[model samples]
Target chain A: MEARNIKLEEIIRDENLVYTKTSLMTDKPLSFCPGCGHGVAHRVIMEVVDEMGIQADTIGVAPVGCSVLAYEFMNIDMQQASHGRAPAVATGIKRCWPDKYVFTYQGDGDLAAIGTAETIHACNRGENMAIFFVNNGIYGMTGGQMAPTTLPGMRSSTTPYGRDVALMGNPLKITELVAMLPGTCFVARHTVHTPLAVRKFKKAVRMAFENQKLNKGLSFIEIVSNCNSGWKMTPVQANKWMEENMLPYFPPGDIKVNGEMVSKTAKSE
Target chain B: MAKIKGAIVIDIEKCKGCELCLVACPTDVIRMEKKVNGKGYHFAYMEQPDNCTGCANCAVVCPDGVITVYRKKFED
Candidate 1:
C-alpha cells in the first residue's frame, strides 16, 4: 500500500485549531455588498461591545431599512423597532433596564428621514444610550431611493435626473445639526474608508459605549458610510469616493464629548 | 536622506478636509484654511510651517483624495 500523506491538520483538524472563535456572531452573515460601510460600522460596534465586555448586559435596538436585520449578526439581546423608531425603542430599553448598556443602530433613511423626530427628541432629552447612524446618502434597502441626507446633484431612483435643490432639496447634515443640541452628552462623525480611519471609528464607538457604562446620557455617532450598489460604484471606488466627496461635506470630529465643547484639535483622554 | 529639512506635503484635490492630520500632528502645525477649493472643500495648510514633524496624520484622514506633505530642500 502506498503511504497516504494527507494534510490532516489543514483538512480534518478538530482540536483547538478548529475551535478558533469568530469575532462575528453566527446568525446571518452580512448581507451588505462588497465595500459597504454598513459592514465596517457593524464590526466596529461589535468590537466595542467586546472591548467593554458588556455582551451579556448590552441591549441593541435595530432600526428599519438596511440594518433592520442587525439582530441576526449581533448575538446580544436585540430589539426591532418600527420605521425610524430606534430612539423610541432605545428609550424604553434603557428605562426598563437601567443597568444594561443600551444602543440604537440606524441608517440614514431610518434616522435622518422617518425617524428624525424620535432621534431629535431622544438626544434633546439626553437619554442614557448610544446611537449609531449610518448615512449612506440613499435609501438602500428599499431599492436605491433618495434620502434626506442624499447630497444635492446626486442622482437616485427618486431623483433620477440628479438631485435638484429647488425640488428635491439638499442633503441634510443631521450629525452637525444634532451636535448643536444641548442634551447630547457625546456627538461625533466619522468614516471607515481606510485602515487608519477604521481605527479612529473604533475609538469613537468605544467612547459611545463608555458613556453608556457610566450613565452619562446619550452619545451619538454619524458614520459617513457607503452603498456601492446604490452608488453604482465598486467597493474600492465607493470608499475612495466617500473619502473625496463625503468627508469634505462633513468634517470628522467630536462635536461634543462629555459636555465639553471639543474642537478639531481636541482628543479624548 | 540627509538633513534636507524633510517635511509633509498634501495633494489638495484628494483631501476631504476631515482634519485627521490636525489631530494626529503632535506639534499642532496643521489647521483647516478658510479658503475653499474649487471642489467646495476646505484644504488643510500649515499653521506654523516649522512645527510639522511629518507624522502624516492629515494625509491619513483626508477623505476627498487630497494631500501629500513633504519639506522643501533647506537652503544651506
Candidate 2:
C-alpha cells in the first residue's frame, strides 16, 4: 500500500504532539550558530523551568560571553552580569529572595577564568543557588582564545601552536574542584552531543533547580559543550571530535551527589 | 491491525538546516529540503513519514528548537 501524505496541520489539529517547544523560550530565533550546543543547553534549561512551573519565580543571571544576550531568548526574569560575575550576582539575588529559584549561566572563559574567584567563593560559601557552566574549552564568543578549561595541546587562535602545556598550565577541572569543596551539594558534568546526553543534562538541570528550593547549598552543573565555529569544524565534525577528545579528559557524569563524592566506578557507569 | 502514523512539522523559517535532527532520527524520517529558508540554508522535511515513530529524537537534538513531532493512532 502506498503511504499516505499527511499534513502537519492535521496532526496538530489532532493534538497528538509528543514534543514541542517549551513556553519558557521566547519566539526570538537563537543567535547561536547552527548546531551549537548553547542552543540545546538553553532549551534544556528552559524545558526544565517550564516543566517545573518555576518560570515566574526563577531568575537567571547570564554572564558576559556569547550567552550575554541570554535574557533575550529566555522568557523569564534575567540579569546580565559582568564577565565571570554571574555567581556573585546570583548570590545576591538568591539572598534577597531566598524563596525564589536563582541560577547563573556562565561560560568557560567567564566562569573558570576571570570569574574563578567569585565562582570559588560562591560555591565555597554554599550559596543557595544553581550554577550552570558551559565549558566549550575555548573562548568561543571572543574569537577563540585559550580558556582555563582548554585542554593541553588544544589549538585556539591564541594558542596557534596547539596549547603547549609547558607554557600554559594544565586544564583546570573547575567542576571537580568545586565538588571537592564542602559548600557544593550537587555537582555534575554533562554534554548534549546525543539524545541520551541531553536527557541526562536536563535531569541534572532540574535537580539543580530543585536543590535551590531545598536550600541545599550550591548545585553546580557543567556542560562540556562544543565550539564548532571556534574549532573551525562543521557541527558534525565538532561533535565527533568532542566525543573522542573532550569526553576522555572531562568525563560526563555526576561527580558529587548530595554533597558526597561519587565513586570513580559509579561515575563511569 | 492497528496502524501508527507519525509526522514532523518544521518551522521552515526557524530551521537552519544544521542536520542534527536528521542524524538523530532513529528511523531516518527526515531529509533536507532542496529549498532554502529565509536564512539561505536548506530546511529539513519528512522524507519518509511512514517510518516515523514520533520518538522525538529529532526534536530533542534540534539546536534551533524548530521541529515538533506528532503521532496518530489509527486502525487498518
Candidate 3:
C-alpha cells in the first residue's frame, strides 16, 4: 500500500521531482523568531532547491534583515550582503559562475528600498538568477519601521500615526514595478498564508529555478510573509493583516510569466 | 464508512504564542490564552465550541512548528 502511494520519480520530469530528502535537517534549530514568515519561506525554498537537485551548484546571497542568519540555516553555499546589496552580489556571482545557480534572499525594506537599484538593473540585464523577495510590510530587525510594502494607515515606528499617503507616500508595489522592465521574464508573488497557497508557491519556486537551470533570464518571486513579533499582533493577526490589507495592494498571484505579463491566474489543470 | 471529524493538534513546545492560527480558523473556535509555554511564547487555546473544520490554514502559515491537522478520512 505504501509502495502504491510512492510513485516512481521516473514518471516525473528529471527537473520536476517533488519528493526528496533535503539537507534541511529535522533536529537542527531554526534561528528565526517565533511566528516569523521568513522561517516558512526559507523552508519552502530549501525544499524546492533540494528537490530540484541544485544544492551543490546553488549559491545564495543573504540580505540584511531578521533573516540574515539564513546562511547558518540552509545547508548550501551562501554569502551575506550589505543591507540591500544582495542583488549586486548575486549579479556578480551569476556572471562569474555562469554554470552555477545564483539567488538572493531579501526583505521588503532591503529589496524594495535600499537594493531597488541593484534589483532594477539586474533584471534590466536579464541576469540568469532568481531573486526571492519577502515582503512582510515592515522592517523587522532594525525595529519595526515602515517598509516599501507597508499598507497605508498601518501603524509603524516610522509612521506612528499610520502610513499617510499624503506625507509618507503610498506603499510601493516593488515586484510589479520590476516586472515592467523589459528584461524580466518570470515574475510571480506567492504566500505561505494558506496550505493551498504554499502548494502553489512551491510550483512557482520550482519554475523559477527551472528557468535559471536552463539559463533563462531573471525570475523574481515576492512572498507575502508575516512578521509576528514586529507587528505587535499575534501571528494570527499578522497573517490576517496580510490577507485583508496586502492581497489588495500586493495581489498574491503570478505577475509575469515567460516574458509576458500575467495579470490573472494562468489556465492550468 | 464512519465519517471522521477533522481536528487541530498543536505542539505546545513549539507554540510561539502567535495567534495566526486563531484568526485563520473560520470556525472562530480558537483564542489566545494568557499563558506562556515552555518556549516562553504565549499559546493559543480552543475557545469556540467545535467550529474547527480542520482546514489546516493554521498549520500552513505557522512559522513555529506548532500546529498539525489530521483529516478524519483519507483522501483518494
Candidate 4:
C-alpha cells in the first residue's frame, strides 16, 4: 500500500499540472452566493487578463449590485463606481490613461436600468474600453427586485404575480440595441453555466480586451446569468430555467463583430 | 501508445457546494463529500480520479473556481 501511494504521488507531480487558479484572483474567498455566476464571470475576465500578461495595465471599474465588492476578488487595479456609473467611470479612466486597458463590470439593474443613459452614450460615442454586462434579469443583490431586463411574466419581489408586460413594459434586449449603434465594434451575449459556454465567454472577454489595442470602438459582452436565490430555485434549476426561458428572449450570439452585424442564421450557439 | 491519465484537486474550503461542477463533468469523476467543510457546505472532490480526462470542464464551470486539474501521460 505504501509503494502504491508513492507511485500515485509520483504521477501527480507539478510538471503534470494542466491548470491552476490564476494568481490574478486574490486569496480572498468570493462573497457571492453559492453557485452564482458572478464568481465564474470574475474568474474568466481575470484569466484573460492573466493570459494577456496585462494585469498591471488593466483597470476594472465595478459598479453596484452583487459585484459591488468586485475589487476585493479581482487582484488587478480596480476602481469603484457609483450605482450604474461603471461605463462612465471607465471612459474617464481610459481617456486619461489611453495606454491602459479599461473595462466596466455592471449588473442588469445597474446597466440596463439605472445607468441606461450612461451605457447608451458611452456606446454611442464609441469609448475605447470594454463593458462586461452581467444580466440575470432580476436584481440579485437587492433581494430580487424587478430589473429592466426581467422577462415578461417573470416573478420578482415587486411583481409577485409575475411581471405584467402592460404594466412593466418589455424586457430590454439591450445587447441588440447597442449592436445597432455604430460605436460598438463587438457585441455578444453569453452565459457561463456550462463548460462550452464558459469557453466561449472567455474568448469574448479576450476579444473585448484585444479590441482596445487596435483602437476598435467599444466592445460589449452581455452575460445572461442566473439568480437562484432571488428566483427561489436551486442553483441547478436556475440555470436550466435560464436556458429555457431567458436564452430564447436574450438569445446568445455575436450580434455584431468588427462593426458588422452578423446575420441571424450565422449566429454562434 | 502512451496512456493518458488525469487528476483534480478541489479547494474544499472555498467550495460553496453549488454542484455545477458535477453537472459540467462529462465523466462523473467528481462527487460531493458527505461531511461539510469549514463553510458548512458539501464540497466537491475527485471520487473517480482514474476517469478524469483533465478536460477542465469542471474547473471551467465551477462558479467558485476551486478545482484544479492535472494531466499526465505514461508509456505503456
Where does the lowest 10-residue lDDT sum fall in candidate 1 chain A? Answer: A1-10
Indicate the residue-level lDDT of A204 in model 3: 91
Ranking, lDDT, top scorer first: 4, 2, 3, 1
Q: What does candidate 1 score on TM?
A: 0.71
CAPRI grade, predicted model 1: incorrect
Query: On a 0 to 100 scale, what is the lDDT of residue A86 in model 4?
Result: 91
TM-score of each: 0.71, 0.96, 0.79, 0.96
User: DockQ score of candidate 4?
Assistant: 0.64
- Give lDDT tens digits, candidate 4, residues A5-104: 2244655679988877889999899999999999999999999999999998999998999999999999999999999899999999999999999999
Q: Model 1 over residues A221-242: C-alpha lDDT tens digits?
A: 9888888889888655676777
Task: Please write out the lDDT profile of model 2 over residues A185-251, one tens digit for every residue.
Answer: 9999999978988998999999998888898899999998899999999888899999899888888
Docking quality band of candidate 3, CAPRI definitions: incorrect
What fraction of the native alpha-carbon contacts across the interface, defined at 8 angstroms, is recovered by model 2?
0.73
* A252: Cα error in model 3, Å: 1.1
Clashes of 3: 5
- How far is A165's C-alpha from truth in model 4 (Å)? 0.4
Residue pairs clashing in model 3 are A235-B19, A235-B20, A236-B19, A236-B20, B17-B42
Clashing pairs in 2: none
